[model samples]
Target: MSTSYDITQDKWERFTFSREGRVLTAAITSDHPVNGVDEQMHTELALVFNCLQRDSESDIIILTAKGRAFCAGGDFDWFEEQINHPERFRAIGWDAKQIVTTLLNMEKPILCRMNGAAAGLGATIALLCDIIIADETAKIGDPHVKVGLVAGDGGALIWPQLIGFAKAKELLMTGDLLTAKEAERIGLINYAVPAAELDAKVAELVAKLQANPKWAVRWTKTTANIPLRALAAQLMDASIGWESVSNYLGDRREAVAAFKEKRAPKLTGE
Candidate 1:
């Protein structure tokens, strides 16, 4: 690993990056209150992993948020923007696909530090990591259908495999948020510790991952993720396209409007 290798020049606006020893931490530093994914942030999410893989000084990475919450899903304001600029979503769909693929392709393990609430795309990212350790106070779910959008952004692909198809469908369709304990009990995430000890739990696991023979850990992760890789290859493009298409239909609009208006959406099934 060359110390001269650099990720500082990358200039990521929505995130801040730092490395200590072999552990690189990427903190979602968005000021949007809830750290939702916008076009730019979404693009970064797709590309950042590859850059870290090339960073010679890094062996494993921790993905977390700086704000009180992790990503809350797509920005509501951005979702509204898609109503008039629906075509833009096609590009986002492509990026979403890349995010999943690149993460799977990376050799180094990723440990998700779910410090707070995670939903929609956030939940997908956390659940997709090699190890997910969350604060007991946090919650997780893919509530895309509640917002009248398909869980096309890796949600449809990852959830069923992590849990089962039956449980996956029930949560996605119902848009229910699970407490961290509940999620772990259902086998949706790896561990849930009290908020006070989250950092310790994360460090313990990171040490375990880092101390193991690097090649073995990386290869084991890669081979174990093979079935997930195939499913993503088979389902992602079509699922994302279906999700993009849903943005044009009336229900999606209604859902966004209702959330902003703080009222129940009236779905006509149009």
Candidate 2:
């Protein structure tokens, strides 16, 4: 039917109609890249989510990307813009809300194919997926603390549920990177396979899910995902609020400065 949104930008970002059935596949290219959740990307992603939701023929969605990194998370340029003009912070908050809401509420199963390193919101996106399949060599982290920001939107909602409160705190507080196996071991991801086998593994999983009775699958998925939805509803706002305030604070400023200078950050409560 409406293949219009099926592919807006060829490899930049696209939805490929699967030959097997009603499953829609999305590829996020590493070249044109998403530098975190910015305005244009946010809008386009929302459009993609909406399109996927409306496509009745689509029973499952798979998100994967090109390159050695899945998503680096928020564009520092946008963050720089926000710091320079604190008034625009609310928009970022709204975008964060929308991104989480769209993924959490998707009626069909959403799977993440983590082909490479994913940090910050990138890791968040993977965690939101119904099933996350990562390459054994791939690394994932939530480095908001390293960037002088709080775990806020993504970490605040999902980390505790995935790995328990203590480990989540340790990782989030230190901004530690977890190998794919460690991620799976900690329950952060579903499986960790060889990088070369990632696509095949993901296909096998998606196909299996797709071939199952649609209603039974959907109901099971819907029930299981309710906890995530509830967590987001209760925690995301407060988390984003702290993150917005962090943008105006010294820790984030030092963090960004250190990143730009390629040096260690020196944080001060001020």
Candidate 3:
């Protein structure tokens, strides 16, 4: 445990990283209203896991955001950039794959503090966490289909694993969000507590994990993540590829426009 990495020194424009004793926390600090995952935030998230994994100071990593929403979704303006300049989607597609793989492969446990609403890639990130403690006001969903893209990033793999294929398919196809309690009941998340109690609940779990044998805790996580890592290895490339292809060919422009305009999208599958 001699690895000496200081994540707080990184020039992170999209997040604020800090450590408290053995617990390192990365808080998404996007300027967007709901802390949308724009290009910068997505890139930072893709790289942060590696730092956290190597940092010996952190026994547990707590992921959260500094807004009313964990992450509402992608930055619509950025999505528009992908639609308008399809060439950029390739880089972002690779980033999407990295975000999932890096987080999954980390030996240190990650606990998601779902303090508010999470949707699209945000939902996938939260669900893929080792443990999720969500505030009751938080809602979660993978609305990629609603925005005319497949739930390809990580949702297609993890949702069915967490909740069952039937329910996963229904939710993925509809792109509907679930309340925190509903998500917990459906087995999509670990726990959902009142907003005021969210920090206390996470702190309790952190203390319990920290009090145990560190290597054993990390090894248990490593063992449990084997299956997920294998599945992700098999599916991430193809899924992210097709997601890029969909962005190149699908009715994403119309769907996004409709969303911003508050109107029905005329999707012809072009």
Candidate 4:
């Protein structure tokens, strides 16, 4: 008999969790126009994976969002706060590390239902998933450099692994967004299907995994993630440290200010 792990007991302000049979779907439910990550959401993102990992009732986990966009990136208000109080940004290094590490440590296979655009940390989360199925109209990218920050979250670690170092450098440096089709062409994501077919495709993949031996499937994912876990251990601290330094830079302030004022950032190479 399957033991029930009550997910509702975990109060999440920006996320909602629900399970059907043994598949738990964790969604980004922030009311932001694009579901941007704020301080609260970031904390929840770091903790949600651990919660889901402990859900013995779940065999598969689907990471998705409730709005038109999966997650557009960081909230502009939150960005400004980090820029203004660089010390506040320091505390997020642990949460940032936890987000990536816990997801990597999860034994259950994660399928990213990329319902819409995913940028910055959103893209990192999607790319780290074992399989990614995106809506054909959606876009994916790590635009951290656009806002004068290093793509140091999981972007540095996962992008290079998925699409190779040369392409990853070009995109991360330029802060370019790729259409779902282009992302698939470059092997950054698994499948780009019509929006209407997104759920059907995810269900199909879920069914295939459910048919297999449970431990065998779970252990296979754990084995496949060994190298990724090693890379995360090696790079996360330095990357997050550099990102924190960028938070204190004049360029970061200018970028956030420009975003809020609806103007181009006047960035000097400060």
All candidates: TM-score = 0.97, 0.90, 0.97, 0.97
> Across residues 133-209, which tens digit of lDDT does each residue of candidate 4 receive?
99999999999998989988899999999999999999999999999999999999999999999999999999999
TM-score of 1: 0.97
Q: Number of clashes in every candidate structure?
A: 0, 3, 0, 0
Residue pairs in candidate 4 whose N, alpha carbon or C atoms collide under 3 angstroms: none
Q: Write the per-residue lDDT of candidate 3 for residues 95-196, one digit (tens) a residue.
A: 788899999999998999999999998998898898999999889999998888878989999999999999999999999989999999989999999999
Candidate 4 global CA lDDT score? 0.93
Once all C-alphas are superposed, what RMSD does model 1 give against the true structure?
1.5
What residue pairs are clashing in model 1? none
Q: lDDT per residue, candidate 1, 70-172, as tens digits? A: 7788899889998879888766877889888888888889999998889999998888889999999898999999888999988888888888999999999
Give the per-residue lDDT digits (tens) of candidate 2, residues 1-270: 455444333333433344346667776653435435565665556556656666656678888776677777767777777777887876767777877888888878888989888889889888888999999988898988887788886787888889999999999999999999999998999999998899899889987986789889988988888888888888889999988888788778878888988998787777
Model 4: worst 10 consecutive residues (lDDT sum): 1-10
> Could you list the CA RMSD of all candidates, in the order they appear?
1.5, 2.9, 1.4, 1.7
Sorting all predicted structures by lDDT, with the top scorer first, yields: 4, 3, 1, 2
Over 4 Å off, model 4 = 1-4
Kindly provide the TM-score of model 2 when superposed on the true structure, using C-alpha atoms. Answer: 0.90
Q: Scored by Cα lDDT, where does model 3 land? A: 0.90
